[model samples]
Target: MFLKQIVHFSKKSIRLSYQFQTMSTFTSRTNIVTGNNEWIFVDNDNFDYQQELARSAFADMLHDHERNIQYEKAIIKTLQNLSKSMKKIHILDIGTGTGLLSMMAARALNQINNTSCSSRITACEVFQPMAKIAKKCIEKNDLSDCIRVIDKRSTELDLENDLQGDRINVIIAEVFDTELIGEGALRTFSEACKHLTIDNENLHIIPARATIYIQLVESSVLQEFHTLKNISQQNQRINIPNDCRHLAGNTIFDLNLNELKDSIRPLTKPIPIFHFNFKHINEMNNFTEEKILENIQCNYDGRIDAFIMWWNLDMDEQGEIQLGTIPVWCYDDQEKIKNIQWREHWIHGIYYPQESKIVKAKDQVSLYCFHDEYSLYFDVGTSPFPPRSFIPAILSRSAMAAFNSDKRRNKYIKVLEKSFSNSSIKRCLYFGDGLLLPLLILEIYPNIELIILQSSNTHLNHCLEAILLNSTIKLNYQIISSLDKNEIDFQTIDMILSEPFFTKSILPWDNLHYYYLIQKYRSYFRSNIKIFPQKARIRCLALEFNNLHKIRSPVKQCCQFDLTPFDEQIMKASLNVDETIEPQSLFEYSSKKPTLSSIIDLIEIDFEKNFYDKIEKKNLEILFIENGICNGIAFWIDYELNENIWLTTGIENENDSWINYSKQGVHLLPKPIYVQSGMKLQISTGFDFKQGQFLFDIIY
Candidate 1:
């Protein structure tokens, strides 16, 4: 005996229309109210009040049973106008979303059948969570004989052979999309129509056509939203979350969707990212696109929630528009929901454009909207026009380090900028990385360019793949398990050393030659290297080895320095701590001591804030690229004489503790390399130390 009211109105046009919601009797406590006017409402009074407000059956969605009943009456009126020669009708309801549209269609068929409605109905749903609830509502209505609910999608329609019949004459699909591609409508309905429909014999509720319209919008809220605080502390995007970790508490003063990304079920969900209606549009017959040109309006004020639209079918005017609904449940723990002063249950995003002057409604706009994501973006076109402009976007932060120095970039910037003016190079290769100088170079200077990232770790392989897919920047990287960019097999290095390469010709790692020079002097290394300096010399001499520290001794002490003749007792060190603890268990606890370098590392963190302020103000463009799996990353940074640029990398295997603890870390250390190709090498650190004088273009 419950009644509800529903209103049917256009979300885009804001036009008032006659859509009513009338609820039919059901055994369940909640009743869905669909209006002949345009609103869809549902009542869940039986559910706990708090539950409805929190995550609940009704989810605080607005509805009325009486309104739903009236809407059903209007739907019946529309169905009656469709055909004249049928006694009974079979219907296939898609998305059965809330079970309201299907229910309306069922009630209308019953009116035409006289006395009562007894036509078969099949509801196809894909989400297990949604399908379960819908099945209960269908069974509670006592329409089980006529309406059968299946927990599946239209793509899997073959399993619903029982729902198909020769006399079946109606397919009521309410799955249209504003931009036919955003919602799951096209994928679901197209497949269903191909298999389940009876050609042009029966009436399709909304068979074809979706003309998407769009224009630029500016909002201040969007700018502020993009400035989210960094949590993990890594200066890279791969460190981003794969799940909804948190939500904004108040109105976002700013917004930015360009960098906001997430993995989800599909686009059918209409992820509301920024709000803007169509200012201009061009349409194709069915599911077409048209661009309304206008200036890009960005905000210094309010935020943008997401682009919004509602797509409806022309199959029957009796059917109402299936408006887009924001499923706020996508966030973790409902962390995304927020409340305003006037509305308690209504959840709204910040994309409402405040000023209309941002983009004119009549101007032709560019269609290459989401251009920065490495897509094949095409600029807006004129009638019978070939698309204008094509290039890729999405630059890596690593690639721009070169241009970070305004003072240093005077010459490089001019070279890159001038090169882009020719427009002859359809594709160019970027070699370096770090601050994404290459990407900015491509953007500032118009040219088709590709960037190759070289990495020694597999950690960024997948992220790099996603970056290639989403950004305008292309990737040429490798995913290898270890260092050795030249594909130098360790076995080969071992083989070469074993036969002709000579035992003394070990590939220099960590400048071990310096260690050899230090060991020969014997005076400095004898003590720490052996503790008993004389014994250390004897061991080194007897072993005929330039380096005794690398060799495991019968002793318990092995330090960074070699023991010379000047020291006391020889401290035989053991690399295997577990093995050493057996002989000296008591000493092991106090002896988990710091090495020389570790002792030097205890200096309090240098809060050298703004140390690079001068360098950061530069307009330089640096390209950093890492060849993934195949080689190392080509990351770079603006060169500074006073500040040292440290290069660090993390591999996928860092997730393991033993591998991590065993010293598998950044391949390139904080060594000073040359700054510019034309500049000479200045003595930075290693001239007197080791690693030899770094010889390069600025050759001494």
Candidate 2:
């Protein structure tokens, strides 16, 4: 119990707590696939990730296959009408893989037993093994009478004068990746259309136009390998710089090919394909390749469900022989035709985007071309071109925009377009504490080239826990120790931490492993209290109150404090120090094996924790007996304080009589111990005494 005073000061440390409460449960699912180098496909048990790979071209190719039977039927219906008198027809199958579509068309023509028109199917394949297999399939289906397979690429079509009937009337090929860039489709189709088609006849292009979409992903792969730089000091050590690459897994770029499809848009369009005055031919060029763009726009705006390019061919009113895109039309429900056997053409792509906007030209976004292993069948040797330099300024801006205001201010970032750098530079630096992820913007200030965080090992695991709990930008840590010199590389950084700074502040208190530190700094602020007094007849401590408690005048001689009889009673009652046991004792650290050396650390921290918890404080005056005994007083400091209780040393010598001095007034701040003597001593309070119940103790 005590009287108190209030003081003012600047600065305060406020602790606020927040938790990211999420309700989630865990369940395990299994996915397994097995195939030889010849073929590869993920078994059904797993989730489909085809679009995630190579622009989902594999899905597009697969779709072509699933539609093979229907395609054959469509063309057969047209063929049946064409020749009541033609007698026979010959078809050229280019880029024939697995013979799915070629075989289907062959059987359809053969099934009708046409005396008026006989048909022959010639399959041309680039890959030798696939051609050999298609040859066997012709024999297996008893279509050898009508179908003959050529073990040559489609580009070699111009050389072959053997189309069963001298000149082929129909051409079929399934070759379009999502970007329409894979499988050399352009070279094959151009040559076939030019050299083989009959005069004024149309050419068939299967799965013709492919629409591409670019997206961003949250992949751990890129982050770990992108930035590379090191920092160090001149004090004799070396450091290594390392980086990683990862994906954010979000779509930032989308492009459409509807115009490109309605008319043929070749990577490099040739004005004339042979001298043939093909019936209807319209096309466009100068469109983009598989190239990805960050901000994009087109003349028209649509969601771009997927690119659709079908057949446009020349046939008489009788539906006479002609060629064009595959007979199977594009299917909106891509998954319904999953099996490949009846497919008229292989499907390759499916860009089912999330949160995608139907953007027109000049819309800012992020995009990347990726290979998705999640597609049902893996490509034999397919991957993607190294991505063009990209950035996710949109995502970053969005995360920032969430704070303070719900409205996003992304319009300003558009200045990046006209003033963008044309030079392709990739200078990188990857040195930031995982503990401070959020401090990235303030500290980095757009300086880093790239940051790749290691997913399981470095980033998610090694992150500091305190930062995770207390702050959003916990990782923007400050340097407690500055470098003496800046030129030294930090790849092999090995610097000793400063003594008091490393000990009392840098490391968190609760979970530290400092048994050795306790040994090393036995004399400095230790971690526990082995050398401290368990029970002292006399003790002295000082504590500050203005910062927290607003307490003052702990000395018994402070006349400035007005203590009524009621206040005096409380102080005397509070003097029993046994009840003031701290919630956590220095001995509790003993169980954790804290040594005498580490025990001293408690002194400094206890000073901060208990500064003005109580109203009274003290100063060490002296230690003597009631009989006037004395020597050089000695005791140990259990904790540090600016104004606190003072415990006296047990009396050593004595001559007799004693007098009580606190009789003048009750102590409030910095309790001073004085042996009673003839000299008149009064325990008056110090400055800043306010009226209140800051009751404290002056224990014997």
Among all windows of ten consecutive residues in candidate 2, which has the lowest summed lDDT?
587-596
Give the per-residue lDDT of model 2 (tens digit) for 35-135: 00111222211211111211111112323322444356555665554455455566777766556667667656756666667667788876554565466
Candidate 1 global CA lDDT score: 0.29
Q: Which stretches of candidate 1 lie over 4 Å from their true place?
A: 1-74, 83-85, 97-100, 112-118, 127-133, 158-160, 174-180, 206-211, 220-315, 318-700
**Positional deviation of residue 170's Cα in model 2 after best superposition, in angstroms:** 0.3
Q: lDDT of model 2 at residue 586?
A: 13
In candidate 2, which residue ranges exceed 4 Å CA deviation? Answer: 1-66, 158-165, 202-700
TM-score of 1: 0.33
Model 2's alpha-carbon lDDT is 0.30
lDDT of 1 by residue, 335-387 (tens): 43432111112222222122122233334322233312111122222333354
Query: How close to the true structure is residue 150 of candidate 2, measured as C-alpha lDDT?
Result: 83
The Cα error of candidate 2 at residue 293, in Å, is 18
